[model samples]
Every structure is written in C-alpha cells, then in structure tokens.
Target: MKIKIYFRIIGLSVLFVLQSCEDFVDIDSPNFQMVTEDVYNKEKTTIAAIQGIYNQLYVANFSTYGVSVLGAMSADILLARTDTYLPFDQHELFSINTTDAGFNQNIWSSAYNMIYMVNRALEGLENANISDDLRQNLQGQILFTRAFTYFYLTNLYGDVPLLLTSDYDTNAIAPRNSKEEVWLQIESDLDEAAALLNKQTEYKDGERFYVNLSVVEAFRARVYLYRKDWSNAESFSSNVIARADLYGLEANPEDVFRANSKEAIWQITPDGVRNFAPEEATHFTLHVNGTGTTITGNTALSDDFLNSLVPLDKRRLWIGEVSSENEHSYFSKKYWFDNDGEIQQYSTVLRLAEQYLIRAEARAMQNKLAEAISDLDQIRARAGIDLITDSNPGINKQALLDTIMIARKRELFAEWGHRWFDLKRTGKVNTVFSSNPTWQNSDALYPIPGEERLKNPFLTQNDGYGN
Candidate 1:
C-alpha cells in the first residue's frame, strides 16, 4: 500500500481543502480550482483526496471515543467517572436524551462528515483520467470507508439516511432507509470492495492501514455475523483464516495492538506527537505515581468484569491497577504504553482474532458444535486459558453458544462496539439488563440525533425517544 506516502501528503494538505465546504455533506472546497479540476487531474492529488478521508478518521471523535469508550460504557464491562461519559453509561436510565449534543451528536455528525468526504472522492474518482487498476483500487478504498461509516450509523441510530452522492440538495431532504435496506447496501459495498481490492502482497509496503482483500473479507464476515447469516459469516471468516500468509493470531495478546503486529488487519495511525498515543490509552489510562497511588483516572474495569477473568488467562495481564485511599483501582491495559510516555500503539479497527470468534459464533448457530469449539479453542489457546476439550462430552448448543459469548466478551472487550453490539444482536440486552430498573427494552437502539431530525423532517426518532 502507498498509504505512508498518501498520509505524508495528507497531513499537510487535508485541512486546507476541507475548509471550502460549509454544510456537513457538501464537498465544494473553498478553492474552486482545487476542488473541481485539480483534485481529480493527477493521480497524486486523487490519492490525497482519499488520504484526506483517512486523516478525518484519525481524529474523528466518533472513531476514537464513540465506538470505543461509549460502546464499552453502554455495556457491562466499563464504568464512567466523568459526567461526560455518564449519559452513555446510564443511557438505559434515560440519561441520554434527544437534546444531549455530546457524544451522541458528535458520533452522528462526524460519521456523516466522513461519508460526505467519501462521496466526493468517489465522484472525483469516477471522472478522473486514472489507470483502470488505480481507479479500481481507489473505488474499493472509498466504498470500504462509506460502508464502514454506514455500519456504525445504522447500528447506532436505526434507519439512518443513506447518502450515496455528494449532491447536498438531494441529501438534505433525504429520508431514513430501513435498517434492512441499509445492511443490504453495506454488504453490497463490502462485496464490491472485496472484488476490486488487490491481494495484500500487491501493495508496495505490506501496510495494513489501507483497505486490502483480506480486510474486506474480514469485515464481510463481521457484517454477516451481525445479520445472523451463518453460512456467509462462516465462509467469509474462513476465507480470511485460510490466508494465514497474510494474517494470523499473535502469540501475545498485547502484540495485537503494537505498531508492527502482524495480527492487525486494518488500523488507523494516530496523529502528531502527543496525539500519537492511541485513543484508548489517552482515555482509559489511570495516572499513578511510583508510590502506587492513583493521581487521575477517568475510567476503570467494573468489578464484575474484572472478577470474571480466569486466574491463568493471559488477557488478565492487559489490566492494571493503582492503590487509592482505601482500595485498588483498575483500568484497561490493552492500549497502555510505557511510563516513559512514547506512542507505541495504533487504533486497531479489525484483526485476525475477531474473524475466529465470528466463525465460531456463526458455526454454533448452525449447530456445528465440534467445529465451533475448534475455533473457540484457538482464541482460548492464545489467551492462555484452558481449551475446551472434546472429551467434556455432551455439550448442548446453548452451552456452547454461552461459551462463545464469554470468549467474545473476554477477547473483544474495550475495542470497538463489539460487546454492546453483541448484547443487542443476541437479544440479551433485556435479559442482561433486567436488574437495572431504568433499562427499557427500547434502550437497545439509540435515538437518532435530535439535530439531524431537525435538519431533515423526513427522519423519525427511535421507538422510545418521541419525535
């Protein structure tokens, strides 16, 4: 991938070009010549346009906090110390309202802004005089970005507006599409991306940041898994797993987040010196001095979650603690760096481990118990937990699925919205949150951001949040 070269140019030029547009989805750059002709005239400039989308992704609050922290807070794994995060943590209690213009709004706006940029790039690519190979690659990249954005949008706010073009007037009046329609579009984009993207080896530098064939396959597996399309989920996941030459499970779980890990299928590089720390580390780390006393810590692992880890599990090493006045406080070590304070991690969007879990769950749903256990064993082995033995005998389907869910909780926690999405998709939100008096069944879906509904009268609020 020529990602390094594109990103280097993007760091310098992305901001200047982005300033030309006023509306959220408009792509009319302030510099008329630069936006209309120059951006599409040259291969480098076109690449930069695509790179600009990546740049937006690097700092987008939605990607950094919305998907990671907010997602975790919505689940049972993490607790919020600040009021800023409390709305998400206590969303089930009606803390999150249509008017709350915090994370919920940021997530919605940031996602649409990126989608707007992507649509502009796609239009530019279509009209550009670029090579067929280069054009196809760029198309794949843009489609993947759009699909990824819609995936989150639909999941976060049900029945989101699906804007396919950069026509601001058309998009402004666009109405929400059904979740099913949105998912179909997501799969279509991923399928096209998989077809057009080159194999991992074709890229100049074996960069995992850019969209490649393996990444497409992996994401397809995830989408299928979410849709409960077991066969497709298993098949797509297996495709990625078979490409061991390109991706594999890292022996150490921490290595999965390191800058040079082979396990990373796709990751967004952090920006600047201070910003070089991955978002998770910046938000999740609890500051403590050499004396082991807590100085400042914003979030921590819930006691219930911490106690759930088995003693010998290697993943337990990814959690650390500091002594407070009377008790020990713990935080996620998944994104932690050294005390010397150097940036050593990237925000991993997709990796090999998730494909395994997806396949395991998909297979279990299909009643392929033995095969499902085999996939789960791979993750268990990597986590240093005891693998489920075939000799255990007479494992029921529900029991095996319960085992897979537990594995997913431990293996994929505090990453993107996997835990939160898992609970929602499995119809377990009500069962899981039954004890919380404030949690209504409707809490499973977040309300559409109030500002969005205001701008487009066609939009409707989710069930619990009145229009």
Candidate 2:
C-alpha cells in the first residue's frame, strides 16, 4: 500500500470521528470506534491494526506521518533544497525561529495522532476475546508503539503530558510531565513490550514494520543512549547484537540501504509505485531531465566531512557524487531514483548498521576498546575499507570514540535525523550549530503546536519559542 496518501484518510477520519458529537452522530457509522473494535476482534484485524501503525510512517503530515522526516530535514545530512517552498525552512524552525505554524503543528499533531490510534488499539485488545498468547503479542505491539510514539514526543518537545491511559476525556487536559518522567514511562512501556514480544520470530513483508521485542529493546537502548545511561544502553545493545547472525552489520555498506534491499532490522517504506522515490527529494538535487539539468537543489553534505572518508570506503561512493555541473559540491546520493519523477520517497527508519555502531559506541564508553574496534571494523570492512590496524592499539579512548562517532556520521548520512541528535547527545549542539546558522537552540525543540497548546492550556512551549 502506498501509505503516502494515508494522512489525508487519517485526517478525514479524525475530523469525522473526533469533531463534535453531532458529527459523530451524523456519521453513518462510528468510524474510529468501529474500526478499533473490529480490528481487535480478529487476528487479521489486529494484523491490519499493526499495518495501520506503519501507515503512519509513510504518511506526509508531520503531526500524523511526517515527523521523523521533518526531524531529519532540520538535521545536517539533508537540506530542504527549495527555500520557502518546503514547510520546514519556510517556517524557519530549522534556523531556530520556532514560529512556523506548519512545522510545529505537524510535529505535535503527528505524535498525538499516533498515540491516539495506539491507545485505541490497546483498549481494543483489552476488550477482545483473543487467546492469551495472541493478546500478549498484540499488547506487546501496542506497548512498543506507545513507547515509540512518546519517545518522539518527549525527545522533540521535552516535558510533554504523559497519557498512559486511553481515557481521552480525562487525559485531554493533563499537564505536561518532566522530561525525566516521560522517559520513565517510555522505559516502562518498552520493558513491558520486550517481555511480551517473541524475539525469535522474523516478520516478512509489512509485518516487519511493526514493533517486536528486539525493536523495543533497540529503541530502549536508543532511549538509554539518549539519556546517557551508557551501561544499560550497552547491555541492551549487546543483547540485540548477540543475535548478530540475524542482525549484524550489512555485508555491503552500500547494499545495506539500496532502497529495496533487505538488511533492515526495521524500516517503514511506501509501496514504490505510488509512493515517494528511494529517498526524499529534499536531501538531493535531482537531475530529472537526465542531462544533468537541475530539477531541484538538494541539501549538500558538508565538504569537510565528505573529504574525511577513506578512498576505499564504499559508503562514500554510495553517498557522495562527483558532480561538476551544478556548482560542484558533494550532494547525497543515498536515494537517487531517477525513474520516480516525484518528491516523496521511501524513508528508512532503522537498520542493522546503526545497531553495530550503537554496540561499538556503548562498548567503547564501557572502556571495551578492543571489542568496540571489532564492531567498528565490521562496518569499515563492509565498506571495503581496511580495519584500524595501527600498532598504537592501547585504546586511545577519546580518539576511538571520535572515530566511531565519525563513522556513524559517514555511515548514516541522511538516512535518518542522526547528526542533530548525535550532536545533542555528545554535547556538540552549540559547537556544531552556531547561532541560527541553519537553525538554532531555541529551535532546538519545535514549539508546541499552536492548536495543541490551545486545546490543552497545560502544554508549555519549548524554550526559545516563547519570545
């Protein structure tokens, strides 16, 4: 299913289902409620419910579908290419102004919408007559989804109102919790999800998009990494990496994300036919006319970083191009699908490469430099580059750490919103991002969307936006 158009459907459904009771009464049927109930009744419905969650990934609305993409856009890997035309830059959040209605509103709405559906699904499963095993699995999925949604919300908005229960009425006006409180809830939800989900099973097709025990663990590791709980982060990441045969470093760093290739530990993409191209157009300048005629300007990769890649590194080939035509700068080539002829493209959410990198970083932080080097070597070897074989091998801790982080930058360039978050986690936000260069610290987190803040007066605006 080309989930590209799903936001419109979801938006309409929300309007029809969430507007005044008169609209609900006017409807020929209870849309959200009936679908919620019907989906819970059957295994197929539950399966579809999971698919519906993946649908959120491919949709275009930042609030309902496009938040991750938007987050990445504001980061370093990708550029908006089109000025004022793209909502991200036009509203100036990328540059830290934070008054953009389109940018903030989309993020707020998207997080809440996913939360709403996930809560509804959890409630549906609770009321369902499914077997305990089946119910547990469904619950696992719901728990992970809720945690995943809140992870995005809290990370972006800091202290957001925690909505653990599905009681829409009472939870509507709840006050914002502290960032620490929100992370606690996130940790709890992932723990429950990991316990319930079967880590042994491998889901095929769209089923892979849904959260599993491993996914929850990986995310928890990510959360811990964000919170700087390096030990727990290392532990969770190690557990996932122990299943290395199932989820190891991609054999070819290039093949790891060849649009349709399958080394993905987790990914959410639209059906190619009607969806976006291999990657979003915002990251790359497209030569659509086939004569190198520029169709759109892309967010160029940093020249200093691009030059740091070793000559033999395969990822450099995959990401950087030698274009002499349009101003001659390094542009991202990760999603260069010429045939698609449109903007929206398949976006990658998670990959095994990140797991390896995470494992390496976590281990190094734990002072396991040799072990960290092994992990880092796996990535470098796949990129056809030589391993770090220097005689001065006594763990130059900070240098090794820097190398691993730099490798992350090279490996995951434009894949997701890594640069900004990576910078934030490493305390490089101010150093890397000078005052309002592209976007600033006040722009650090997007403003609480105007509509959401209005609806819930308890919602506090993120810093730097109030002025």
Judging by lDDT against the true structure, name the best candidate: 1
Task: Summarize candidate 2's per-residue lDDT along 1-467 as a digit string, tens digits.
Answer: 00112332233333322232222212233336665555566676565555556665455354222443566566655555555434453325532333356555655655666666676667777877678888888789778878877877776777888876556665567788898998888889888888888674466543445567777777878888888788898888777777755665656554555443455666555433344454354446434445764544545565666677877778766665445355555676666554646532245566767777888888888898998898888788788877774534675899999988889888876655576568766877666657445555665666676666565677667776662
How far out, in Å, is residue 18 in model 2? 11
Query: Per-candidate RMSD vs. true structure?
Result: 4.3, 5.0
What are the models' TM-scores? Answer: 0.91, 0.83
- Total clashes, candidate 1? 1
After superposition, which runs of candidate 2 have C-alpha atoms over 4 Å from their true positions? 1-35, 63-68, 85-99, 204-207, 258-262, 270-285, 288-295, 320-326, 338-346, 435-440
- Note the Cα lDDT for every prediction shown: 0.77, 0.64
Candidate 1: tens digits of C-alpha lDDT, residues 358-431? 99999989999889889989999998877776445467899989989998899888989899999998989889
